[model samples]
Target: MAAAATSTSTTQLSAPYRRSSTLQNSNYNKNNNSNKVPSNGVNGDRQVMVSKRGCNGVDNGGGFCWKASFMYWTLEDVAHVARHHWILCLFAVGLLFFMAVEYTLRMVPASSPPFDLGFVATRCLHRLLESWPELNTLLAALNTVFVGMQTTYIVWAWLIEGRPRATISALFMFTCRGILGYSTQLPLPQGFLGSGADFPVGNVSFFLFFSGHVAGSVIASLDMRRMQRWEMAWLFDVLNVFQAIRLLGTRGHYTIDLAVGFGAGYLFDSLAGKYEESKRRTSLLLHKEASLT
Candidate 1:
């Protein structure tokens, strides 16, 4: 009878433990199923449906959809740009003002003579030129001397300084100038001063759209600055200004010609630098391949 009683007690205790174990297994299976995404064909079908919807949305909206995706500019973006590019914002305002001015400005009559502010400002120099015609010749001779200095410096940069960028830039600038100058020839300015000592001596026909003298000097000056030859750079800049004044005073070049010359010099120098960089990169890639082989 005691054996029977102990057996009944043991069975009763094990019954609750078995029930708890079964409940835990059921909970675990539910959690595992909830965590897992189904890998059946239905999931893939749903993904394809979503993708089709997106394509349809874009097709229906046309450019608007693309703009919405790419150009979602917000106030934060404007604030960020304003903080970083305040200078550009100021320039934008200036550009708008100038555009308005240009739109409102009156056009000069086709029969009217070409007018240049520099020419107007140098009225005294014009008077001097008229008073002593030989003064024009003297200034031309001085300008020739400055040209000689520019040539010497450019050549020296290649031969002595072992830097050929200035020479390369000059070559590019002159070639472009010749092409442009011949393509569109501008009429020579009136009240002109000619001299036998001037460049392209003996009054030879030359391109007047852009001044090689100014461009050459600018190229040399830029190279001087790159070399940290500050004094030489400053001297060249000063001489260039004087040369421009002389060109203006004597009507050797129109104001547009001188301005374009400065721009061309800077442009060609940048081109030369790019050319050197490309060459260096090519040589490096070749060396790397050769070593690997």
Candidate 2:
């Protein structure tokens, strides 16, 4: 009797473990099954299913299915994702664009001198506003603030929000501005006179046709808009207008320059928004399909 009771207890203990092993195998099989689909799975069914192994390996789908939360994507997550192929490509493009812009600024002179509307507008604005010393000081202060805000926003977008689009947009604007700047090679307005501090680089005798400040402002503004920060968008828009006026008032740029800058920046912003939205939608669809499967 004693031996039989002992044997029964051992079997009872082993029974639970046996059941546990079977449950684990069942789960494993289910996961494996998810990677397979019925013959009609690929047909035009209203509902679709996705498999993790199939999506990540069997197909050439990119690694963008991972869910992202704005509050959770810390700098570390950004660094991790920055190593992705697409991000790497963006970085390469941004670097090349930056170098091109810098080279253009340093080497190219305007192919033709400024004439017509740009020169006339600059001449008039300089004559009217160049004499106001206090106004110049205030404009300088505003420009400084604008630069500070733009830099901060870029850092936040790229690092905190994990947005590579911001970097690309900035590089694009710089390249466009540089190309225009070198192409126009227009001289400063005839009455262009301001505090000597305005041209710290001492090349104030010329360099016109497009305003980098206004372009930078516009890019920053549009980036803020994409982030869905209405307050920031409004603030940057107002600052951009002020920056454009400052460029004209200080004889730093012509009206045409501001207009071109605005156009180019706005165009880039639209393109970036579309690209980002498409990527987001693709990722969500894949995730949902995978979950359903």
Candidate 3:
């Protein structure tokens, strides 16, 4: 009975020891868990996101940190933070220039001396007018497609790429060409398209110095090529040639006008490319400086 009582007393003493050890072990585990960092995926997300995210002004030496808040911003918000005001300004200026050119076109005298080359080409092409119905339909279709492509390029460059130089260059060239077209005050050819169906805007007698269609096509083609849209570029290039021929056949533009238009398009495209390159370099330099400091 004495041995049995001693064994019970030992068992009671060991139970307290076990409880104390269990408490110590739980405390140790809590400390270990507290020291350990969470492995949730925020670090990986940071590596994938743009450094500009959550940046209010230019980044001033803060290493890339992805913020969920910045990632959720809309395109307009991003563009605003990027300071894309020049795009809006260029568009506004282009609109003003268009209005000015249209006014000049309206004011120019209807009777102007026609270039001999244009006269000769128009006379010859006019003789081939076998079917007005077919010719008109074809011309209308081409015009519609050309206008659509030009509009798409303008929107893509400005809205998607946040670049307005292409649109600006096109607008500036178009205005300048229009001024030149009206300055000559070229006389309308005898077989000139007169009806509203033939000339969507008005008489083709005024803006005949260079084929706007050809110039626009060349600009759109070059811009498309620059944008890395190879198929679109080639399509516009083909359309350019086709439009040139159509202008000649319809007596809408003289040969000299077409030649000048082609040259102008190339020249302006080069200018726009240079402008865009400079802007890109500047942006890169600024971004680098911002990152370093």
**Index of the highest-lDDT prediction:** 1
* Local distance difference test, each candidate: 0.80, 0.63, 0.65
lDDT of 3: 0.65
All candidates in order of lDDT, best leading = 1, 3, 2
Model 3, runs deviating above 4 Å: 1-125, 194-199, 202-206, 278-293
Name the better of 1 and 2 by TM-score. 1
Better of 1 and 2 by lDDT: 1
Q: What are the runs in model 2 whose C-alpha is more than 4 Å off?
A: 1-128, 194-207, 271-293
Error of 3 at 281 (Å): 6.0
Give per-residue CA lDDT, model 3, range 1-293, as digits (tens): 99988555443312323334445447745764676534456643432232224322222344353223443445544454345455666788899999998888645344655444554655655565434646655575666677677778876887898878668778778888878877776656555543344434444345777766677778877777777889988888877777676667666667888899899888887887788799889999999999999
What would the per-residue lDDT of candidate 2 be over residues 1-293, giving only the tens digit for each residue?
99998656443312323334455447756765786544463431211322332221222243223222333445544554454445676988899999988878644356744444654545655555656677676667667677777877876788988886766677776776667678766666545545544533333454465666666677787777766888988988888886776676676666777787788777776666677799999999999999999
Number of backbone collisions per candidate: 0, 0, 2
Candidate 2 steric clashes: 0
TM-score of each candidate structure, all chains considered together: 0.70, 0.49, 0.51
**Best TM-score goes to which candidate?**
1
Clash pairs for candidate 3: 61-293, 112-185
- Looking at model 1, residue 7 earns an lDDT score of 52
Give candidate 2's whole-model lDDT: 0.63
List candidate 1 segments past 4 Å from native: 1-90
Ranking of all candidate structures by their TM-score, best first = 1, 3, 2
